[model samples]
Target: MKISRLEAGFNYAVLSLFTISALLPLVGVVLSALTPRAEATGGLAIPSSLAWSNFKAAWAEGHFTVYMRSSVIVTVAVVALTVALASAAGYGFARLDFPGSTPLFFLLLIGLMLPAEAFIIPLYYNLRGMGLTNTYWGLIAPQVAQSLAFGTFWMRNNFKQFPTSIIEAARLDGASEWRLMWQVALPALRPAVLTMCLLLGMWTWNEFLIPLVMVTDESLRTAPLGMAFFQGRRSTDYALLAAGGMIVAAPVVIAYAFAQKHFVRGMLGGASR
Candidate 1:
């Protein structure tokens, strides 16, 4: 079957419209970041002379080096732990039959529906009691738990759609369960795993409430939280604000640029499955 020319044209037009809509604000922000502070009316005006120094100013004054370091540590830890733990649990739920499996999986799904806001207060008290507050663990542990919920769900769906024939063949060839999972199924599901990593990376990097509630140390602030403070101090300076915002956003954008192919494949394949 083929789309008619009129329909194809209409689809393209709609996509183009949506693309422009998405890009317009980003364009405005980029232009604003580049414009001199005095001339930054914040309405998408092209700068006569680029204010590249705004980024340098924001970086030093906002203490972004410290913030970015903390962000990287937390994000990396969350993604690594979530991916490893979630993949194992997802495989167990999807492939192995056990007592209480259905109910247990449902309980895990509860994490997906509940927002951090619902338990943040009690969570803070709990972490404080454990003496984990204002530490890197304070930031990392909760995020791992949150990311795991979604990561497990994502990987389980992918695993469930895996070919049973391959598993059977591997079993007959004396492949242990561990070997089969680590060597065979996981490799085949690279795209899905990568997609999970990218999604979790973005979420962890942008997480504000968890860090805000968990840590008081200025050094422990993540990029987004740091940007909030930066914004407060430079509220009147649009150029600096935009530059700071871009600095915080750059890592996720760079990650996506590198992993976009795998991300797209995983999404489309998961949908199809």
Candidate 2:
């Protein structure tokens, strides 16, 4: 009994060490953001005075409000498209049967394993052909495509775990295919939906690569790309950059904080099944 207790205690100590290690940088950023702009380069120590004005300065200098709008529009659109398309594709792969369905699904699943960087050039030209470069549609369309690969893969696995008995019973009760999927199978997918929503939302929200590559207009920048410009302009000020980091991370932190429980449950359910 003593040995088991000691082992458990040691494991907890390791876990605590890891947890603190992960959080220290975030804490430092927050502290730096709250300090005066002049102290941005004043090393890692806490400043003598707290300066709430740093947040305002980051906001103004970064043009965060405009970038935020662009970010929201892109994120929301991508999430919605990813979920809708992935849910349908996932359900189809798991439940429906037709010619070439398996092969087509395999092609999509293969895409999930492929690196997105491999497609950057092709994607760029494709966007240019669509005449969508430097626009919101160009920004969102590609993100949706990149994210859909994983989304479909995620939902496909989840749907596979659901018993077909219920679906068959619904079919016998005069339910159409759409009705069975929408009213029955989908309701049981809450955990998966939550998991996917959280995943896609985070990815799309924090995305910089696609936006940076596809968009060039200063007015159309997403938050992270906009922050790069902000940094260039305020390159001498480390405090403002730290504050900008805080601002960028705050919404994600708040969202995860609220949805944490469901997020964990969803991940476990999908993985365990």
Candidate 3:
């Protein structure tokens, strides 16, 4: 059904208004970052001269080189492990039948409903007992477990909706289950997988509370956690605080830009199904 011209115009107008509302803070942050410290009045205003040095100052003061390195290591490891394990689990849940499968899957879903705060204290003690605290593994392990529930849910739905004809044809050709899953089914699910990766990467990258409670090693802080500390020290310096915020946010923004096509496609496809 074609929309009326007036309806189309109204839709466009609403979207534009929402888009601008979302972007205003980002635009303000950018302007604040560029404004020289002396000229910054803790409010949005165009800078007379770009204070590019603020980024440099924030970088050094925040020791973001170390923080970013830690964030990358944790995020990459968590996403890779979560995706791989979740894909296998999702495939099994979607395609296989076995004893306790239904009950086990329901148990797994409990992870999704629980908030991080619910178990963080107990989780810290458990990790500490295992000598994992204040280490990269401490940070990486919890995030992986936390992500797996949603990751499994996401992939299981996608896999369930996969075309059965292709699976049957592969089986007729004497393909093993592993071959069918890794070679045939996964390729068709690339968009969904990429979408999961982009989301998990962002979550892992921006995780602050997990890092805060899991590790006290200054060298082990992630970008967001580091930015928190950076903010505390630079509370009075609006320009530097804005610059530091951008530094922490830049990676997620860049990743989303690159993967937006796959992300949008995956979301739309999921919605359609």
Candidate 4:
């Protein structure tokens, strides 16, 4: 059951190599962001002085304030809706029996295989017709639908793994189905819910194609789409580009850093169940 010293050393070496490979680009980006515009020749090098001004310049030029607000609003809305709807659907499929539950779950699973590209054209027209396009709902609605399939599947498995005795006790105490779902079941599935929310939030935040297609107004452009525009305009300005990139990526990184414990637990729990 124990790994030999040589094998352990080999594994450590392999992991270290992968770690460094992953970190090297990030290191280059951070260094580039700090370098002066003139000095950043698109090559990674320690700058003579850290130029915090690059971020300021990028912020103003990219209109990141507006873009970040859009992204946050869309992300939060999608995540909130996805988590709420998915948890309910998941618990129903896992615990409540219905005539078509199996078929319905399979139908939902079909969504996971559907590429956004397939339905984007119809979706855009549909949203436009509904007067949702160029608004936050235009951005939020599709992502919630896209994320729900996986979220439902994730929560269903986790809910299925919950202790039966606990639910029975709650039922004995006259807990209504709504009370059981909100108070007992959901609280017990916090880690799984949190994990799904984080994943969904990241997806919604980073979504480019949907927002790009749905919103023509610059104000509605999410961070990623705005970053793309900034990158195109400032392709030669590596420092500003790097700064913009960092600004766009920082939120998801910060969120993950804070909630990684729950994220890991949720993934493990879902996998085990």
Off by over 4 Å in 1: 270-273
Global lDDT of each candidate: 0.92, 0.85, 0.92, 0.92
- For 1-273, candidate 3 gives per-residue lDDT tens digits of 999999999999999999999999999999999999999877879999999999999899989999999999999999999999999999999888889988999999999999899999999999999999999999999999999999999999998989888889999999988888799888889989999999999999988899999989999999999999988888989999999999999999999999999999888774232
lDDT of 2 by residue, 1-273 (tens): 356888999999999999999988877887888878766663667888999899898898889999988888998999999999998888888888889988898888777776657887789899899899999999898889888889998888888887778888999999997787778887887877987898898999899888888989977899888888888898878789998878877777788898898798888885332
Lowest summed lDDT over 10 consecutive residues: which window, candidate 1?
264-273
Model 1 TM-score, 2 decimals:
0.96
Top candidate when judged by TM-score against the true structure: 4
Q: What is the lDDT of candidate 1?
A: 0.92
- Please give the distance, in angstroms, between residue 28's alpha carbon in candidate 4 and its true position after superposition: 0.6
Could you give the C-alpha RMSD of every candidate to the true structure, in order shown?
1.7, 2.1, 1.7, 1.5
Each candidate's number of clashing pairs is: 0, 1, 0, 0
Cα-based lDDT at residue 26, candidate 4:
98
TM-score of each: 0.96, 0.94, 0.96, 0.97
Model 2 bad stretches (over 4 Å): 1-3, 270-273
Over 4 Å off, model 4:
270-273
Q: Following a full C-alpha superposition, what root-mean-square deviation does model 2 have from the true structure?
A: 2.1
* Clash pairs detected, candidate 4: none
